[model samples]
Target: MESQPILATGRLLLRPFTLADAPEVQRLAGDYAVSATTLLPYPYPDGLAEVWIASLREGAERGDAAAFAVTLARGGDLIGGVRLQIDAEHSRGELGFWIAQACWGRGYATEAVGAVIGYGFSALGLHRVHAIHFSRNPASGRVMEKCGMVHEGRLRQHVRKWGVYEDVDLWGIVSPIRAEIPHPLRSMPV
Candidate 1:
């Protein structure tokens, strides 16, 4: 498979991860505020970031997933990461992301996710892209909403996190055609 290309947005750049990014990944993703809200383990172990970055290439090669390092377009500082876990047979992918705690509420997550969702639909020819967040983290859901993703439904106690079952909210956006049509019970747009 061809390598994932760098994606650009108005204020952000989504590019392939590099070994040099390990330090910052460790620093930002290590925080419980970041890790606890996602699947990442708390007290992030040493060298795990490097291991994760290395696996991204392998996953891409196997056509299973693609991960991107989210950075600033101007200064190129690594601030977060986003990923698309592909299910090619179904023409869909699962989206996931995290931003540094310091960058919260700045619209960076929405910008980065929008760029990747565009890539999934336009570049990868995907039919749909979906994401889920722990129910406690509504901010993450807001990012999905801002990217035009509709709230699909909530999975009750669907995931075991930190020894507790956590509810998850699923959100998704289908291709443009699917987005335009109204449901059978709903009136058409004027």
Candidate 2:
């Protein structure tokens, strides 16, 4: 696979991250309020953004990831990011995203997520796309819900974040195309 295509929404542009974006990515994503709710590490270390940005292309080239810099469509200011970690063999992708704390409550997360899911199902031919959020952060779960994901389940003490175990809520949406394919077990005699 080559470079991921740029995605557009009414108020935002989902574009690939560049080396120049390292500073803003560091500034916005490094915030404690933003990092606390998501998987981003607190006291975000120096030069980590550059290293992370540099590493994204390898996954894109392998057709296994699509990491985007979320920006305002009008001014092109970097606001946050969204991604899909693809599992081609299983025809699915794990979705993740974050918005700068200043931009919260404006629906950017919901819009970007919807676009990425559309890309996953249509462009990537994924059968299912899912996301998970720390159970304490219902706002993130709300973003997933607004995108039409169902409350799949919860895992007790599923992830160790910042040295503490945190429960997580799983959410998912299967492609409409999935129903077109027959399940192998559907035809099995009970």
Best by lDDT: 2
* Model 2: lDDT of residue 53: 93
Q: State the C-alpha lDDT per candidate.
A: 0.92, 0.93
Candidate 2 TM-score versus the reference: 0.95
lDDT per residue (tens digit) for residues 1-190 in model 1: 7889999899988999999999899989898999889998888899999999999999999987989899999999999999999999988999989999999999999999988988888878788999999999999999999999999999999999999999999998998844565667676556
- Cα lDDT tens digits for candidate 2, 79-158: 99999999999999999899999999999999999999998998889999999999999999999999989999999999
Quote the positional error of residue 40 for candidate 1 in Å.
0.7
Reference-based lDDT, residue 93, model 1: 93
Question: What TM-score does candidate 1 get on C-alpha atoms?
Answer: 0.91
Worst 10 residues of 1 by lDDT: 177-186
- Please report how far candidate 1 places residue 109 from its true position, in Å: 0.3
